[model samples]
Target chain A: MATAAYRDIAIHLGVDAGSELPAQLGYAAALAAGCEAHLCGLFNRPCLPMIRHYIPPEVIERHKAECERAAVKARQLFDAAAQAEGIATEWYDMPGSALETVLVQARASDLLLLSGVVPGDKTARDYDRETLADEVVLALGRPILLLPGAPKPGLPKTILIGWNGSREAARAVHDAMPLLQRATQVTILCVDPEGQRGLPGAELARHLSRQDVAAELLVHAGRDRDAGSILLQTAQDRKADLLVMGAYGHGRIRETVLGGATAYMLGKMELPVLFSH
Target chain B: MSYRDIVVHLTLDPRNAARIQLAIGMARRFGARVSGLYTVPPPNVPYYMGEYIPTELIQKQMDEAQTASVSAHTEFMATCASAGIEHRWLSSELAPVEALRLTVRASDIAIVGQPDPNPADPASVPYGTDVLPHELALQAGRPVLAVPHSGSVTEIGRRILVAWNGKREATRALHDAMPLLRSAESVHLVTVGPERKGRTLLAEITEHMQRHGLRLETAIVDPAGQKVGMALMAEAQARQADMVVMGAFGHSRLREMVFGGVTETILSSMSLPVLLSN
Candidate 1:
């Protein structure tokens, strides 16, 4: 078996006064150390909308000062974390919308890491966490690891892959190969609808085996609406530290309406979830 | 990740030998097994005349198909045995399109032939089989390597040219070709489009590939009024790339068929082997 390594990893840093910046940097640094890769931290300093007529000058100055302060804090945290982990690191203090800045910077790395978004979490931009993850996954064409609020600084030991036999799922699996290869146990969880044809996850099992990844398959008959909860429960039961899945959406790229399972997972992600679109 | 199982679609065309040889070489490189799939289009009879067909005629058609499959199989076996590679032989009774769809499930990558529009030997590639490559690439859920009908491919994955447009399909093709690109001597990432601002995606990709230890020579080519596909092929030729790795189609098949897309142009007029994943 040829073990693959991710030599370049990027992390999305939300330049806010006080947030989960340290924890996010800590987890990302740990991963970069494990893979011996260069870690690039992208700090998004939100720029105010160019509507001077509507906004007052003092308000704009206040916002700019706040952004500058947060950017400094973010860089300090990132440098300290990377130094502690003793990994190669780079930092970019970009001035723009959080989503656009992160998307552009993320294209230069194999894997991306970010603290899971939540409502009222004081992120740099005024976008929801789910929206941030979805936009980057769909537009950037890279695998993103959404870390929980305060994740332990290390890689996953037991990984769970949500398989549905779609193109998105396949892409997620391949993108997560580096993590999968390093894990001690891997399980392919297939939640099939009432009466679908030929074993849902049997082919994926064989496919992974061919790549020298021996995976255990667990299938359950359930409705599509319950897939998200079922996968979460399975990961918890198996003690999986990482959840790998496809980010599904339909319609226009920008205005994508996520599928049920994808939406549910994004809203209620527990462990570190690696999502690829 | 490396391919563990490879399937080569075998037709009666003498070029079948080239496809098999390429597969064998790849199998040797990856330490994998090869499966030769032999399929022919159903006897060309009108669908409305289904039940009225005579038994002898059907029998005769079936026999000819069997004979073609047998000869192809014999050659496949001989080639693999001489190469001393682990291999399998499969002949499907199902429709060519359907058979390939099912067979590709067990394989990581599929090797198919570019349909010869004006085949010198009609028996080699019948009229209906020209669509198999496109069909398999789109529907197989696996990467397809389409070998040109007239190329003598002495080397594959040596000097490679990748068409990058920052689309979903292009991303898939790039990652799918990683295993091959890892061993290639040179890789050129060419983007065919007009100059535009905020296109830092290419620079980011360059940094990404550098992390993978692949030094990519990137170029931005303006189509300058030429078709995107034509410009891409011209770039490939100018670079003297032995193989072209690209995303199959950015547009839907129906839309591409009607409006003419890059995938169609490349499929219709490829001078070298191309690897595509939709």
Candidate 2:
């Protein structure tokens, strides 16, 4: 059988997905260099709606021009940075309807590097930032390597995977394979889990082992703490470079909307997150 | 890593023939043992009809299912013989999905079909029903390659597309996809939207794909800021690629499934199969 590894990677650029361009762009470039793969930057520009018939043509032209400026600006910045790193890179930029474009591109990308948001931030739009992250994750059908502002740079030396025996979590574990195998240590953290499936984390651990990922399974009580908070705490305590887990929301997974653990993690993530749905 | 053992769900539908062919092809490629987990569901009887249900009718129905099971087992053996691969058969009277789940060891990668959830389809099998592939992937503790029931694919992973991002999940998926890519004629690595500007991830991906001897080319597309999912689908179609390979979701299926976004869009609309690791 032929062995495989990543050949491509994508990063979200623009004020919409990530405002801190240098940190993420620098990070993505370094990642592309690490993998020795070509890099592609999509400079997306957020635009105001421009299809109104009653609006003056000049007004529409002005709006279009404004959006184009943003695209040009983002592209120029991306180009300069990509070139400085001496990386083979491509650039894509457009105005308005960026979310849809990004999502569609996600279909083709293996991993999407997105900017994580701090929880309780005003709506990224009319919606919550975490929910928006969910939309990106669901829409992309790709693993998301999410980085917060001022991301702690470099590959994850220590990783934490939140295990709950859900399909999403399983996907996350499998998706996180490349990083997990590379990491010096991996901890399977199960928080307040009922352990519904027999040998809950063992099989997953074995699966990782087969990939040469030495993992330790740790079950935490999660006493008086939400699963989201507990997971964050564990990641911080472990000094993990990456956190892997499934994004959960809606009735599609379980009945309780309750706390919206996945959403919380996306909003206030402390470390880079590798999420698989 | 190689999949040493593969378990393919065996049912009595016309599609099982194609499924078996694909599984056998994989077995041959990987030189792995293929186990046909044949399942026969008990006749559908009411939930709590104690004495009201007629015994003879139920018995007759059960006998028919058992007969079908025997036929399936025979087919499996024949197919295995023709393929000249190491094989085994394990048939059960338990509900097909549950039975396979129970019989399957955690280490074995499962091969199954994604039957149309619509009950109206003429080709649909009663015993082997919808969402079997998803359930197996979740329960089997192993990767599940889901072939849609509506179409047939004789070979898989020949000319492939690696939808890559530098995330660990994508990284993991790339590793899982290696066995298929190693033999592939071409591997296209692509990313959408803006570039991550992360050099380490891209460099590593190039080195790894090259090491496998895959004819690899990486590109970035401007979907002109279109819905990323549509952009991705268009790219896949444009290439005439056999399948699109990538990690499944970066979030839980619960919220994303409800919103009915990109992953769902691809699952429903993809003309080719998708190799999803996460």
Candidate 3:
């Protein structure tokens, strides 16, 4: 079983200032962390040149004031959310690029909180937001909690482990230990096993036992199915609300060649999966 | 390309049987050939006698290992043939990565099993050394598809997630993934962090893909108050993406920033399979 690297959960609240998702996710983090959640707010400062361009030369003296005013408003909103959750809150104002600044701060936090920004079109510009999120994940080396719209009432109860005997799987299991320990039922499913000797599920079961987390291991031997399809089926059969496993395989150069199981699950599995590399 | 000619690498340990079967199934799907390579320990000499092991003795052991490898490959190919796929087998003493790399060099792809699930346990041997998929990826110079020791999969490539950052690595990944992206029903270009001014790199990628007739959607996220890695995971879930494509970011020896903050975050905490290019 793995523990999250960080104890603090940092929520990146967009400059929109009024979005409800940030607060909702904040409350969820508070509940998940119990005593460990540290809620913080970050404001995206416009680049100095952008600010200069937007404001007239005569009003340049007020530029600093305008930035401060926005920061103050963001702080107030973040403070309000923290107060509502009855947790301590911190605030910071970032300059230059929002993603870069947020990433820098994320280095010190345990988990990152974000709100999904839907692309208005399929064009390149629309991909900016998605690219930024992916970049943060690829660049930061931490886990993120995305607030789709609103936060759910509780953490996942039924958990699924995508048992692959890979370093990534081991790391994912370790990362997910915190959540797995609290889940009501845990299932470790191995998709294909015509001749394999050992399964990851058994190891997970043992790890859970040490932690006193109850879990069950299931080995599904599918002769011809892809690993991903098998995992999705097992998750569905087990009624798992969350899936835990290692993010499988990669291609040589750039393309991600998902191990059959991971690729399939990503495509069709609706259950939430906790993954780590 | 169809999987018919793909050669998959198999670990010597019997524990990878499940993964091998899954690989055979994939090969079948693509009408590909299947080959199993068994890696053996490097030969050692006895110090007392100051003599090398006899060639006959080595041959006998090699023969036995080859028999087992053939048996496994044959059984797997039987399954594939039954499913109407053409398949074959190859056995060699090369390291698992080297053997598989050679087999697949002129072929289509290589599928390697993940190491044992419990890496902490010393006895497991985690795919017997030569099968470290990451190491293979670094050296293969060809595409390597990694399969988890468990889990079943048949078809691949559907909803694709492109982890776009305006970087050379990201662009390389996009270029490598053209085949999958071209066939994908929907492609999501996910960007993180704060807003950027002027023409963004992600936009350029989107335009390029659009020119290729790919159906795509773009998303932006701010890991405000949260770790960037976690935020991307959340977004990947929200998009319901099957696979993520990005550049393998790391700094050169002299460059301390190696794998910037976001790249490091995603690699350590990635929930989805990320394709990375250096």
Candidate 4:
């Protein structure tokens, strides 16, 4: 619960003037609302490249004007959402890659809100929706809440932690603790866990007790089913609202495969998954 | 970090109460508003068979759906009222999965019970989706907390087994699980390897855990020609790790295929809870 309290939150607003902009803005508003936080809408205006010697000034100026117009529009949108939510808000219009912009801005921010980059949809500052997660998460060194392309406004209530027993998973749980503690219910779901070391659920339950985050372990003897599918299946079966799990649990190459859990879940997740990797 | 709106997909299953109670507890914890959503299916009558169904049978189908809807709403309201959480109720004539999917908004998280594939005591309007959670997680664009059909869930994030890979996902999973580890009764960190740069990697992780104050000892398992996933499961079983934290495989498409085999192996053969982050 203290996660968003008294912090600087940055939201990435891309320039493509597409649908993703609102979702990012909306989520930022929701996160900053009533949290006593400064919500900055970091708008990546697609201005002309700094190489003015190669291009004519008139053309560059035209692009600059267009980009600035978009930035104004984006700021207006962000301001409206923030005002509606009664949160303190600011806007920054910068020209450059959205990914690079976020990486720089997030260094001073406690949290970053980003919209899922839709493949082929031209976003502001040439933001690549598909690769944003990997590029930003790896370099930002901050927590980024990725909103599904069309996100609805609300914090996750019930949560499913994809407990795979990886250092990555551990980090996710650590960063997500504040949010996990605030949830009404959380589940530790294991799909065909490689539990040669211990009984899977018992120890985790005891550990959660210390945090007052009562949790139960559910093991799926996955038979001819992928872990990602089973995880989402079990989550839906339980009617969970949120998924908390570590990202990239397998060899890096597997993520390229469609059957891989990380790839599958990221591409086809029906829920708001808080992935940290 | 607080849940403002929480939605529960109410089914006609008997275990609905358990899921509801869990959601109620979550709402109370974060001071969130609860929304009870139910998707009542039409009766599987002679209509699907393309047979001339009797009027009485058709009437019965409608009646059954109505009754199930009313009952689910009542229960949801009662639970929210008792828990003293703000609440709302929404239902649709659509398929159960579809209803739950539409209910998901960026700011809202949904709680739904898995469709009972084989309901020992099926409700008047029975439904099942062994794949609902998966579908929802993909389509809802929100987080869906899935409780098992058989277990009674109270909380999560305790007694965790962290599968360390010294990779991006592994590092992410560890940090994500930090809050849980900080409050855990015990924490176990394990790395499966064949001694390739082992000592340095192990030491690095050890130092990281020490910095974070995680007390569990780390186990570097030598697969001994066994698959890394198998080795991890064996270690998890021995440790009774209720939860396993590891990174999901989403690095390179080519590597995805090669790595998919191992991650796929764990996904298919898991025997305990594993937290996968990507």
Candidate 5:
């Protein structure tokens, strides 16, 4: 998911321009330095109703020029960022609806970085970025990094992981490998430890040890403590800057029946979280 | 934080009155406000030759029903006032999904009921039928505490299971659950794997927990020839864990269900309530 944020949506779409570009570039650079970064840029020609309608030729020309200008500026910013990041970059420009373009790109990208659409933006006529982001999360079935303002400065030093033995957690670990490798200290806290095994915990510690990361594993065994509350406490105790984990584990069915830790954490945690599904 | 200002979402089903009363008692314990929500299907429209008939009267009736619904809801809220719990009524024109999203955003936590049995197949049962909790978890980005529709709210969180893995997700979950852990009676750290690396990870986890002033015990499961999920389930059941907290396990959408080993296993097999953080 982080990869897509840096490569496709942020870099290619040039949504990182203005205040957001520098931090986005920095994150991309950090990633490239640590791992093999895949850079994908998406170009979407929005099927604007105004453009599709049989309007006067003059009006069509005017709208075309405006869009072209925006495109050119975005291109310049992206090129500069990509050049500085020193990563291989690819661009996908398709003629379709904006939503389709995003979905297609998101399907391929690791992380999706989306620029929130202002409710009353004059330039974009119909698209609602927030709703679109949510839809993309549901449709493309990937995690999304919604950059409300500029990206947070610096790579995360302290990372709080909401661990459950679910596949989402495993995917989150893989997704966070690059960052975890660079973090100063990684803490793995088990909220309900009454019967948790020591082997898997040791394996994870061993993995981090090989990566040369200073890691700690902690178990919080308590009765009646839900996973979400335990995770929040651990994050607070460690002063973690970023939390990384999987997205929703159970679907509509499992969630409705058993409840989900991810849902609880999202609602409670205030820190920045990197989620991958 | 003080437990005052609780927001409860109650179903309007008459049979659920007992459940509503139980929820109100919980709210009173926390000194919170209660909100009753009823989810109804959007009014239907008849189709004409090409376009749907615009039934103005039907629209008016729908509007009036909504108003009456809110009024009835307000009466329920008044009951809260008598009990010293603040209350309010809310009606939305949006669908249940959107309305629930809005409710989660507006409140701290949402309380919802469990699903009912399917009428067509009486033997078949439903679990969490309301989409609100999961949607709120995913989209509203809030923590939701779900109560059984029939049971009473007991002491919140007594025996918690931290599905420990040395993964980023597990670590985050542990941290997220610290507040409750500090007050827990006993915490048992369980790891399912070989003992070699397990010892070191156990030491690290033990040290971390010690700092938090939580007494910890460690358990190691070999899983041997069995899959990780089966082993974990056996261990959890053996311990009689009320809740199992673990990191969500999956990848891309398609690969998540088909290729994912641990997630599929847990989703299909878990007998106990599992807390999954993705």
Candidate 6:
């Protein structure tokens, strides 16, 4: 049987550094408890621009104090949540660049959980939320579960996988095996532009069958409609709690030069999305 | 994961029977259905050379290939029947590597044989037979078990030694081998390198395994100037492991070919059955 479990899960806590437990943490803890995994909370010090000399000393001191306080609060909240969930836990205070430090620390993690919500506060000053998520998704070499803006009450029971017969798509499907095996229902969505194959998703469905996942296949015509829109519409229509798809891109370029569906989903995802590059 | 769809590639080599028996044993253990794949060699003569060759000679070659394919199929079916497991047969005219690549995606694992170091009749060996297993391991996106041609491997996965390094390929291979690891009588995660780095990586992986209800016997070997592949094989033999599991092609293929990588060393010098995934 496929191992429907993750042994190590790490959550990004740098953005939600307030004195409260973020929903992603609670969700991560619950998942850890379900699989007996060790949950690690990774919080990196806030990144400030190098123009510190031009800034006032008092402002710098105030920012430093706030960051120190946030770190302590985040640790306490993380510990309490883990205790509440009753799973093994670890806390790390990363003291370097945000993305690099998190990557170095979470190298061995099976899943890295990050919030998809970028703070809308105009006055907020911290790491660049837009690029951080993209960088991690591309460079982590592990699966990333991007949480919705609002937390769902429980874990995902229904999963919709986007398959396009590409290497990235194949990797995403395989990496999402643990979740797919546990989902109550799985629907494989294949957007065949040419509609050449007699049955679009039969091969992948057969492959999943060997792993004991009975999935329904949904094939759609690409006639004039963009793939990203088609996927998003299907996901919404089906009320899928989770979307599993490949985070497609090369280097620092976004979907403009590469995968349009990935960019669309990343920007407008209403449900939790699991992405593997 | 437990493999339910198992594929064994059959050729005309003498070690073909041993490979079939190994697949049957595995199917019996995992409750899997075996599929015997026999790929017929395409016409040796190119289109340009076709006009120069005699039609009678071409017909004779085609007849011989058909005879070989039928005999191999018969033997595979008989072996599966006596073993009392579900089985299927697939014959393709595609090249051996391409056929296995397409067929293995739908299957859980592939059972292939190591190339014979010296063939009794080189002419009889099909084209691309020697490099089939190695190429499949790198490009097939599935775990492949290559049975050594020299020895009779009656028991596998009983005692497994995993060659570990904290790299992406190794992590993938370890996860793909979980089904076998869970059932093994004993498993050892062996790493050979600097002491501190090895110990830390082993500790993390050991903890991960512990969560899966497996207690791994850990080892950090001192290479002492020995090559990584040789060191790992020596340790597996010393520990009496029946099987070896490791990643394939950690470096780029071109770089490995030029600089001599660990994966090449193991593939050429392997004595026991090796499970490899990339």
Identify the superior model by DockQ, candidate 3 or candidate 5.
5
Q: What level of docking quality does candidate 4 show?
A: incorrect
Give residue A117's lDDT in candidate 5 (0 to 100): 28
Residue-wise lDDT of candidate 3 within B1-278, one digit each (tens)? 12234556654456446555655655544444565555554433345545656897767756766675666766666766775655555666666666654444334345665454445555446234533554554444334555544445444567777766554445445544555676677888777766462125455345445545566788788878886557776887787776666655444543216435555565445544455443
Model 2 over residues B201-255: C-alpha lDDT tens digits?
4654575455445567776767696765667778877877787775555345564
Q: Return the TM-score for each candidate structure.
A: 0.86, 0.64, 0.45, 0.46, 0.39, 0.85
Between prediction 5 and prediction 6, the one with superior DockQ is 6
lDDT of 2: 0.65
**lDDT, candidates in the order shown:** 0.77, 0.65, 0.55, 0.61, 0.52, 0.75
CA RMSD of each candidate after superposition: 4.0, 9.1, 19.5, 17.6, 20.7, 4.1
How do the residues A1-277 of candidate 5 rate in per-residue lDDT, one tens digit apiece?
A: 1211122222335332344445555554444434455555565656546544567878768766766776666666656666776666665655566667665444434455554322223345223544455455445444555443343445678887665544455445544655676678788765555664443344445444534455787766754336556666678778886676655534431122114543333323334556555
Off by over 4 Å in 4: A1-6, A34-36, A47-53, A118-127, A193-197, A223-225, A249-270, B1-278
lDDT of 1: 0.77
lDDT of 1 by residue, A179-277 (tens): 887888999988888656568888778777777788999988997667777787788789888889877765422123234444334434447888877
Candidate 4 steric clashes: 158
Candidate 6 lDDT, A1-277, residue by residue in tens:
4455777888887744432246666777887786568998888887656684587778779878877888887877778779888888888786767787666555467788876542343224323554676788765657788764545535578889987764456557777777788788899988887878577678789878777899999998894246667777888888888888777665432343224555545435547778876
Per-residue lDDT for A1-277 in model 2, tens only? 1122345677777644445666677777776665565677766666555455476778768867866666666677667767767778767674555566566554445567876665555654424334445677754556787776546555678998888766567567766665676678899987754545455577567656646678998777654236666777788788877888876644321112214565455445446778766
True contacts kept of each: 0.38, 0.08, 0.00, 0.05, 0.00, 0.23
Better of 1 and 2 by lDDT: 1
Better of 2 and 4 by TM-score: 2
- lDDT for each residue of candidate 3 in A1-277, tens digit (9 for 90 to 100): 3222234556665444334445454554454355345555656765545563576766666766776776776676566656666775556677767678776665444456655432222335324443455556544544554343343435668888766554455445544655676678988776655646455356446545645467787877764335666666777777776666554333310114234335334424334445444
How are the candidates ranked when ordered by TM-score, highest leading?
Answer: 1, 6, 2, 4, 3, 5
**Residue by residue across A54-112, what tens digits does model 4's lDDT show?**
98878878888777788888888888888888887666677777776666555445566
